[model samples]
Target chain A: MAGENALNFQMIEAAAGRLAGHVRETPLLNSPFIDAIAGRRVWVKAECLQHTGSFKFRGGWSAVSALEGAGGVLAYSSGNHAQGVAAAARAHGREAVIVMPEDAPAVKIANTRAYGAEVVLYDRATGDREAIGAELAEARGLTLIRPYDEPLVIAGQGTCGLEIARQAAEAGVTGGDVIVCCGGGGLTSGIALALERTAPGFRVRPAEPEGFDDVARSLASGMIQKNNALGGSICDAIVTPQPGELTFPIMQRLCGPGVAVSDEEALRAVAQAFLRLKIVVEPGGAVALASALFQGDAIEGEDVVVVVSGGNVDAGVFAEAIRTYGDAA
Target chain B: MAGENALNFQMIEAAAGRLAGHVRETPLLNSPFIDAIAGRRVWVKAECLQHTGSFKFRGGWSAVSALEGAGGVLAYSSGNHAQGVAAAARAHGREAVIVMPEDAPAVKIANTRAYGAEVVLYDRATGDREAIGAELAEARGLTLIRPYDEPLVIAGQGTCGLEIARQAAEAGVTGGDVIVCCGGGGLTSGIALALERTAPGFRVRPAEPEGFDDVARSLASGMIQKNNALGGSICDAIVTPQPGELTFPIMQRLCGPGVAVSDEEALRAVAQAFLRLKIVVEPGGAVALASALFQGDAIEGEDVVVVVSGGNVDAGVFAEAIRTYGDAA
Candidate 1:
């Protein structure tokens, strides 16, 4: 366990060094409105503005860079992570093969292609992308860069937490609760390590979307738990059914209590961020803010840091989401 | 002429002092994609993220501050400027009375009210807002804050240009063509002064909406001009019939050749800014970018600055605009 912890921290540091300047140091915005509503001073870490519009770039780039001279990389994702891997591969001047579900938004597929990635489509219900991805990797001799399960990828994802800690320190928010939207515990695990290393007293919290509360249940059970019926949350980016093996232990050890919020709350938070801050945040990116607003009592009077994780929603989807839940004003 | 020039400059300086910290120093983003299309280095001064979501805030705040201790302020605007005055008045702890056309989008009216202003509605065809505003001001002893005609307001608007110049200087854009979306020339005049003072070699240009090219014709004729029909452009914020008396002379002295772009181009520019930079820009705010993309050959090889002046579009309008012209993504 001690050796594993040391390795995790070392990997995160290495990932940070490797991915520097390739991704944006997304703004950490001070929100008076959210603070008023939550009864806490809230600072939002806007990773939605990250390159390729998600925090996945950190892990994607980290994973690809670790392969060093690996000829090509492969990934299976329906959303932001796919774009992240594609963009990261392009940045490193390597070919990327992405296996996306057929029902993926046309914009996402086009964006992946625009980044010079070859996209292979499969039916969402009938196909196993992991199996297909594995086959393709073996055939092409390309390294498979899993979206979240790998240690290198988790370490890369932790750079966001490192950034949050750094930004929070600058804003005098040391030792506060840092809430991140969690899907497979990849981002949560990474953030946990960052908080533990940089700000030891700070509490790292994972916010899971309602109906897909695997992380929350896993933390309570002291072991990873699967949600068999994982309905689509508005936070599609973080709607994984189970936690990653490597990420789960780190999250269990370092993270604090988990919070859950409804899809409506997430949509409202996205609208608020867009209208008030003039930012375009996807539903998934607004999960942290949703947690702050809906689960305010959990973070009462504690200076809170909510990570806005990505902004890659299609225009049509965004319009529908806003119409469904946005405040009239 | 010299006295008028001195007055304009002084008002701008005073407005800058008065409105400091109340407004954002919105980012001036360098657009690689736009530059590639235009064959020029295109930099966008994103004022769309300004307080109240438009450059109108500068003028609104400046005008209200000039009224010093006035109990209430009154203004007539269709949207962005109305919200600007309302919000600015609230910021200064004064009551605001906005005379808006009833035909204005519900969102704009709600936004103005959200800023704590009293909204007085009048019919666009049957009721004259100017007459209504004057009567209200006279009855209540309220100060009348004109949208753009006043020297103080122009000076306040000029601060946006001042910021653009300061930001451009910091970014090492020493000399270039600075393009502003033109309405009544308030923003253009203000920016021209800022460029002349800070970046002497920079040429300031104004971009007018197609079919509403009064500023372009005015520059050519050395006098203010008006268009008979003015509803063709998506740049609603800059569809003014003629340049203000105080603003036209400044624009004439400092502005270069004017350009115009279609409504489709303006709408597309707004979508591009949102996708690329994650900034919400209104149609008028995107005029300069539209001009750059559509009229690329005009500024070939030159470093160009396009001022994205506002971002207060209604959700309905934004949805329609994107559906019609946001095919670029």
Candidate 2:
């Protein structure tokens, strides 16, 4: 059931019911700053304010809650997914252990532990976190919850798209372009499914960091593509090597060719959000907004909806972003 | 009607009906960081993301929509109230003329004009803006929209408290204490009326800046209290000299003795909000949060709701806050 290939509208609907009151229905922000950049109106789905500071929590809760027994959860992630799993596990009264990279941001690590998750750090250069997570899961009788590939996780992520469609309708928008921050493509694929069923005319696209434009390249080439290297971009949370095996098929079916933004552009998007939207968005989270702002010419829409994926950023890094891009004011 | 002595629940309910589709129903945020500070649950009503970046728009729209025919609207404000009035007037297809201090944040002045309001700048030190507003209103045959003193304005601000009670009830908080950032007491007085009507037993308190705590002192002394200085603090949004005669009576009757926080404390609260809540809050907007965090022992109730009043701050000031108080992370 976890490795299932397809996530349907029914499963997503059920997930929404399960997560009805558990997760926050983050606001759909309309900022003039983003509108000016696009030369058109822009709607922002502020997923940054979601519990544990990311959209990953939706999937985390969905997966952990569906686990068969009281075996608890074992997950591997750089930061956001780790916090999601940890927070969900704590809420469900299940034990959690996260296999995180040794160099994950100090804030994310602290936040993960604050949810009562035991941390097992692995060296990013020398160790395989997935292997460590699998071994830990097997040794401790824990269910291994994949960050994105699982059908339950994908269904959980689809709930955000449901919210997007509802909020757009409430704001009197019939259809427009939708941008999703992409790493392993879980969020993109999930949103694609939800929008397909709900707001059928609304199209979806992936936005990725320059060095880690795996999803964009894959979408263009009609096949899987791997990033050249990790740790090359400032958007550390989304530094996945490649798109997820399960998520890629769904993306190819429903999404368009995507846009890639530089780290500098993402930081500018982050600063713009602070100045105009008054929301704190992390680097990975800002990529979709970066694409909307910097790649405005390529984006075709009357109203662009950019999903700001998370807000779990290092304070020093966020401060520097404000200092660098905030000089214009 | 403009300088009415009292506003009631029925008026606020009618204002809510008028404001239903015009304004953003800003979210009530639950944050663990704030919860830890008070050793209890904390819910923040983020009015900072409201149209024109403050709760002032509620009053602005409420007032302009109820005005007499063909005359347009005139208002005096530092920034938030100006933008609100301008935006409300623009939406209602009425001309807006604003009397603002020349040294107001560049963003505010620009936003006001962006909404098609005529900008008339005055020196805060040497000029009387109310007189300027009055002159412009009489010359243009426009209805003057007082920032906080009017009954309609107070009713508009009351909508925020109405939202708070509704949102808190949805979150399963039966009863709690509410801390509102006070300027001329419009928001506090309005909220006092709403909570009294909708969510009885929830006590409300005013939180103000140290030197400019006119509402706080007034509540304590059971009489009007004036600030010794008008511009010593960085909170430019809530620098009213004294409580409004119309609003002060409502505050004194329904609110507890207020708590005042220093400029330094307000800045810390602003930074804390950024790091934890991922929301940009102006110094004036964060004073309620400041009181909740610093005056922990004094604050009663298992649940506390703090209203973050506005987010219309200059980018440079927000950047400085991140640098100054974000050192821990």
Candidate 3:
């Protein structure tokens, strides 16, 4: 297993340097209405507007660019990471092969292919995605770019925390909890590590959908935990089976308590983001925001920061979110 | 009438200084899919993500901050400017009274009021909005903040142009057409003036909805023109009776030929922006992007920069847009 010592501020700073000019420095946004709802000053880091419509691009670029050889890369993801890796590989002039489930959103599949990646779709219920990815990597001599566990990928995601630290200061936010949507604890732990060195007063908390709260359970139990099922919930982008072995330690050492919200709450946050912030956020991407807005009792202090992680949602789901909760928000 | 000499680079620079911390420096985004659709490199300046969901906030803050006294401000707008001025006024600890038509989007009116502005509703068919605003201003000793026909407001809007020039250069765009959604020629003229000074090689082109092509006709004829109908298209934010006396001269001198697109094309751009850029762009705000994507034969360049000016769209209209064109995009 990867140790905690493998990731550090210097590595993150180096990743920041490598990722410069390639990654977008998404802004921190807030609205008075959101603040009113949260009953605090809320600052949102809009990573949803990041390249590839997610924060995964940062990690993908960091890992892909860190490679020294001319070999291609491989990854397995339900959606966001696949596109991120595809785009990053294309930018670096290296081929990418993505292993995704057949039932993945058509938008995600089309977008992945549009980025020039060869996509291999498998049945989620019967296929072993890891074995498929491993076989393809070995057969093609491609480096498997792990979504969250890799040090370089974590370091890349830490760049977003660096931005949050800087932008929060600019927005006059001294300190608060920074909530991140947790899949395999990649973004949550990466941001936690980044804040540990930069904004020491700010805490990182992982937010997950209710049925897929493996990260939250693991954090509470102080041990590795797994979800009973992986395929439920509208938040497909953040329905990982368990916390990453490499990431769990960092999250345990640095992050605050986890927050889990329902899928409906996630959709509500999506609608609120569209109505107030003029940005698109998927159900998985809005969990952190849902926790920030609705689960206020679980949080502390008068200020809070939330990262809107991604925006690779289907049109039907997005429309339903708006139709159901557009007025209430 | 406001003269062209009243607005200049120095004034825009001063406005930029005032707007440094108050306004968001929205980023320029592009997707490979968007570039493919445009048949060239396309850069979208996402002003829709600006505070108050539009670039109007920049001018609102500029005009409100430039005021010499503690008096409140008064303005009449369909929506975007009302919220902009209201937010800016509240930010400056001054009162704002907005005269809006009753038929305007409820979201805009509520947003304006939420910013602590007192909203006065008028009938679009029978009541004269300007008269109501003028009487209110006179009775309450409030300064009248014109939507576009004022030097300070124009200079404030020019700040967006300055950002476009700098951001386009950072994106490695040397020279290209910068298309803008035009209403009373405010944003168009402001961007034209700013680009003329900062990026001499870049040209500005005003884009409007099909029936509301007053600015396009005026540009072609070298004379002022007016639209016969005021309330026709779903792009209500950018529908005006005619170009501003102050703005027309700058646009006439600095802008290229105008471009007009169908409302269907604007809605398509809205759907495309939602899918590709992960940002909400209302129909009026998407016109420039629509022209940039659909009117390729009229434009000349390897690269084009288009500004999505606002995103305070109603849910029904936005849902319809997504339903109609989401698959097509």
Best by TM-score: 3
- The candidate with the higher lDDT, 1 or 2, is 2
User: What residue pairs are clashing in model 2?
Assistant: none
lDDT of 1 at A200: 80
lDDT of 3 by residue, B1-329 (tens): 44778788899999999999889999899988898999999999999889999999988999999999789999998689998999999999999999988987677788889999999999988999888988989899999999999989999999999999999999889698999999998889988899998999899999999999999999899999999998879888899999999999899899999999999999999999998899999999999999989999999899999999999888878888888887624
Ranking by DockQ: 3, 2, 1
Candidate 1 local distance difference test against the native: 0.80
Error of 2 at B306 (Å): 0.6
Which scores better on DockQ, 1 or 2?
2
Tens-digit lDDT string for candidate 1 (A1-329): 22345546778889999987566667677534456667788788877767777899899999888776759999998888888898889888899999998998887888788878999999989999888988999999898887788878888888987888787787677876888988887888888887788888678888878878888899999988897675556677788879887788888888888888888888888777766666778887788888887788777447888888888877776666655555454
lDDT of 2 by residue, B137-165 (tens): 88889888888889999999999989998
Expressed as tens digits, the lDDT of each residue in B1-329 for candidate 1 is 22345655566778899988676667677534456666777888877767677888898988888775658999888888888899889988999999998988787887788888999999988998888988998999888887777777777888987787777777678887888998988888888986777678788889988888898899999978888775666677789878888778888888888999888888888777766666777888888988887788766347888998887766666766655655534
Q: Which candidate gets the maximum lDDT versus the true structure? A: 3
Clash count of each predicted structure? 1, 0, 0
- Candidates ranked by TM-score, best first? 3, 2, 1
